[model samples]
Target chain A: MQDTVLIVGAGPAGLSAAAQVAGVGYKAVLVEKEDVLGGAPILSGYARLVPSGEWARDAIGRMVKRVEDDGNVTIHKGARVTQLNGEAGRFTAKLSNGKSVKAGAVVLATGFTHFDSVNKPEWGFGTFPDVVTTTQVEQMVTAGKIACPSDGRTPERVAILLCVGSRDRQIGREWCSKVCCTVSANLAMEIKELSPKTQVFIYYMDIRTFGLYEDRFYWKSQEEFRTKFVKARIAEVTAAPDGRLLLKGEDTLVKRPIVIPFDLVVHAVGMDPNMDNPEIAKVFGVGLEKHGFIERGEHYTNTCGTTRPGIYSCGAAYGPETIDDSISQGMAAGARAIADLHGLTRKAS
Target chain B: MAIHEKSLIEPERLLRHDNLVVDGVDVSGHWNTMITPRTITDYDDDFEAVIQRYPGAENVHRCWQCGSCTNSCTMYAQNVQFNPRYWIYAVRTGLKDEIIKDKDIIWQCVSCNKCTSICPKDVRPEGVMKALAHWLEDEGHMPKSPSRIFDEEFTEQIYARGRIEDSLVLLNFLKKTGQPLVPQWLRVFGVRLMQYLPVGLGMRFARNFFIPPRTRSWGRTGEVLRQYVREQKEATHG
Candidate 1:
C-alpha cells in the first residue's frame, strides 16, 4: 500500500495540506467534522474576502476543487478522529464514522470557533433583535440586502463594534485577535457599498490592520468609503423605546460622550480556541499552549511541527490566523510531513 | 512622579528672573520662567472613599483613566478646564488640593448622563461628578452652588408633598440662591407665556403661587423620606 498522510479538518489549512500531500505522490486521507467542506467563512456565507473583494465561495471553492480532483486524496465528510495512536512513520487514527486510517504522519488543522457574543451581555446580542454578530452580518451581506432584523426595514444607521472579545482583561482574553480589525473594516465597506445612504460607524479602541491590509482595507474604508471611525470602545448597547439600538461610548479623540441611535448593530466578534482543543490534544498525544492551541515545535523554524515527532498542526488550530496565512501554513505542514516520512523510508531501507 | 497641571498653577507663583545667570549660562528668557515649587503634605487619603459613600459614585474605583468620561463630558466641550477624567484621577490618587482647585466649576455639571452612558468601566462619571460636587460643599471647600441649591429645593418639595409645585420650587430656589425673583430671561419668557396662556389657566397659575399645592394624604411619607435621608447621610458620613 502506498504511504498515506492523515489530515484533520477540511478548512483552508486542511484542504491546502491535503492538496500538497496528494500532489507529492502520497495518498492523503482528509477528515472533516462538518458535513460539508470550507470552514466558517464559507459555511456562514461570507460576502467577500478581505483585501480582495472577491466572493468567498469562489476563492474557497478553488482550494476545495484542487483537493477533491486529486486521485491520491480521499475525503471523509461528517467524520472526526476519535482516537489517535502510535508515533512517527506508523500512526493510526480511528474515525467516528466506523473507519480507521494508518498514516506515515498526521496533520491537525482543526480551526477556531467564533467568539459567542452572548458572553458579553452588555452588547445586547441575545437581548436585542437588531444586534447581530459579524458572521450573521456576513449572511445578511450575502443575501444582498441590508435591513434591520427586527423590522425588516432598510437600516439608515448602522454601528459596527470592534474587539468584542479580544484584548479585554475583564473577559480574561488579553491576546489580540489579530484579524477582527481588518474583518470589521471590510464589513463596514461592504455595508457602505450595499446601502450608500446608510451611515456606518466603527467604534474601536485601536485599528490594527497589519501589513498591506491597512492600506487596502482599513484606510480605504475610511478614505474611499467615508466610513466614520470612532476611537472609542463602546460600553453598552441598549435598545431605545423606538425599537432602535442605542450605542453608548465616548469619542476618545473628541473627548466627549456619544449616545447614538442605530437601526442595526454588528459586533466584530473575536476568535476563541476551539472547545474540543483539549480533548483533541489528549487523543493525539500532543501538547497544547496555555491558550489551548496545539503547540508547535519552534515558532520560527518549525512552525508546523508538533511537540510529538511526525505530528503537525497548522491554521487556527495553532492560533488565530487569516485564511491566506492558514493556507500557507498548511502547505508548510505538508512539506514537513513529507520530509519526515521520506526520512523514515530511508531509515527503513 | 507628580502630575503638574500647568493650568492649575497660579501666574503669580511663576517667577521669571530676566537678568540672572547660573553656571555661566544666560537662562533669562522665556526658558528662565521658574515656578515656585511647594511641597504638599496634606492629602485626604479618605477622600475617594468618602466620595464613594455618595450615590452614583460607587464605581469610581473602576476608572482606568481611559479618558472616556472627559472625552464625552458636556461641560468639557464648553470649558476645556472642566475635565472629569483629570478630576477622577485626582480623587482616586487622593490629591485633595488638586481637585479642590476646580471646586467652583465642578458643580456646573448639567447631569446630561452622557458620561455615565459612555463610561466603558461603568464608572458612572456623571454620578461621580455629582458626588464630587457634593463632597466639595460638605468638606467646606466651597459653598452650595446655584445648581445644588436648585436640586435641594426641588427634591425637598418632592419629598415633603410626594410631588412638586414648579413655581414654588423655582421661587424657593431663587430665594435660597439670593437671585432676583424673576430674572431678565424669565421676565421675557413670562411675558411670552402670558400671551399664550388661557384666562382660566392663568388664574389657576396665579393661585398656585399664593397657595402652594400639596399632595393629598401625604401623611408619614414625608417624615419617612426625611428619616431615610438622615439615616443614609449618617451611614455614609460616619
Candidate 2:
C-alpha cells in the first residue's frame, strides 16, 4: 500500500480531506489539536449553519463519523505535528504523541480562531456579561435558550453589532470578515424566533449579505422576522444605570448620533488567523499572506497548494470561509493531495 | 432596505400613505412609508471621466470608498451633509441627480485641503469639490456661487497684472456678485485699520489700492498667461 496522507486540524476541511484520501485506496492520518474531531462546528459549538440551517453538531458530526468509520484513516486525538521535514513527494511528520508518520503529501486545514472580543474592549465584551460574541450566542442557541448570563432573564431587546474586531483601521484589521453580516442577520432572525416578545436591532456599517444569502438571511430577517437593520456601527457599548447595555452610534441613515439601550449585546466577531499559524507555518515550511492567512500559489493553477510543494492548505487557513465552502475546498484539497500522492508513489516504485 | 447612505432616502423619495388601501381592506397603518421606487435610466456612464476633466480632479477614479476624505473634511465636520466621500461615490457611479440634490451647499466647501491631504487614494477631494461645484454651474443646475465669483475675480487680477490688488479683487467680486462695494464688516475693519495704521504703511496701502502695482516688464507675459488660462478654461469646460 502507498504511504498515508497527513491531514492537520481535522476540521470540516481536514475531515473531508482525510475521508477523500482514504476513499481513493490510500492511507490517511488525521492529527487534531483538540481531543475530539469536528473543527469549529463541534469545537466552538456552532448552532444551525447558514443556507442549510442544519445543526452544526448533526452536519459536521456526520463528517466526523465518515472519517472515523474509514479504517484506512488514522486519527490521533489531542495531538499536534511538532515537526515536518522533507521534499514534495516524500516527507516525515513527528506528532506530539511520540509517534512519526511518513507521508507522500501534507494537507494543512488548520482553521481560523474566533476574533476575541477582548481585543476591542470598548464594546464591553469581557467587562459586561450581557455583551457576548456571536459564537457565545450560537452556544446559547444550541442550549435551547437565549438568556442574559448575569440573571438568566429573557432579554426584552437585543442588539447584534457587526464588524467588531474587523474592518477597523484603528486596530489594524482593515479586511472585511465576510461572514459577520450574514451571520448576524441569521442570528437576529433566530433571536426573534426564540423570543417573540424580544425586539432585535442589527447595527452595521454596511450590509454585505453576499450572493444567495441576500434573500435568505438579510431580507428574510427584515421581512418575516421584523429584525431592525440600522446602517450604523455602534461606537461604544456602555453599561446603563439599571444594568442595560447602552449603544452609542451615529445613525447615518437618519443622520443623528444616538444612544440606545439593549438587554443583550452580541458582537459579531470576525475570523482571525489561527492562533498557531506562526508555529504551523514554521513546521510545515509554508508562507503566510499579508493578512496572516496561508499564502496560496498561482490560485487558478494550484487548487490548494501552499508555498512549499507537496503541501496543500484549505478552509480558513486561506481566509475567512463559510463551513460549506470549507467542506467543498476540503474535497478539492484532498483530490489535489491524492493526485500528488499518486505521482510520488509512481516515483518511489 | 435600510440604506446606509442618507441621501438615498430623501424626503421626496419616501411616501407615507395616511390611508392606504390594497383591495378595499384599508391596510393604511399596517404597512409603513414606502419609498417611491425609482428605476434610474439616465445614468451618465462617463460621469467619472467628465469630473476628471476639471483641474485637481484627475485622481477621482482611484477612490476605494475608504471614507478618509469625508472623515477628514473640515466642511464635513461642520455639517455631515457636506460629504466629499458620498459626492465622490455619486460621481463615480454616475448618480448626477444625487449630486444635484445638495446643489446649494456643494459650494460651501472652504477649500481647507484637509480631505486632499488625508485621502489615501490621492483622490484630491478638495479639487473634486471644486469640480462638482463648477459642474453644477456649467450644467446650469445652480447659479454662479459667490465663492466662484470671488475666485474668478481674484485669479483674473493676478493674470491681468502679474499680481493681485486685494482691494480690486474685493471690489470686482462684490460688483460681479451684486453686493455692496463696502460691506459692514469690511467698513468696520477699514475704519480700525486706518485709525491704528502707521503713517507710511497707510500711505503705501492708498498708493497700492489706486495704482494697483503691476510687475515690471509684464507687457507680453501677462497677455500670454491670460490667453493660456482662457484656452485652459475652454479645453476643460468642453
Q: Write the per-residue lDDT of candidate 1 for residues B1-238, one digit (tens) a residue.
A: 3335556777657776768788998877555777775433222435667888999888776565678888888899999999998887677646677678788788899999999899876889999988988788888888776887898988898899999998999888878888898688989999999888799987899999999998999989999999999999999999
Model 2, A41-113: lDDT tens digits are 8988888999799999999999999988999999999999999988776789999999999988899999998
Separate DockQ for every predicted complex: 0.01, 0.01
User: How many collisions between residues are there in candidate 1?
Assistant: 5
Where does candidate 2 chain A have its weakest 10-residue lDDT segment?
A250-259
Give me the runs in candidate 2 sitting further than 4 Å from their true place: A347-349, B1-238
Residue by residue across B214-233, what tens digits does model 2's lDDT show?
A: 88988899889999999999
Task: List ranges where model 1 is wrong by over 4 Å.
Answer: B1-238
Per-residue lDDT, model 1, residue B159, is 94
Question: Which docking band does candidate 2 fall into?
Answer: incorrect
lDDT of 1 by residue, A1-349 (tens): 2288899999989999999999889989999999889887777788888756788899999989998888999999999899888888889889999998999899999999888899999989999999999998888888998888887999987889999989888887777889988998888888888998886777888888999997788767865675666677888999788888888876564454667788899999888888889888888988998777788788686668888888899999987899889999999898888888887888889
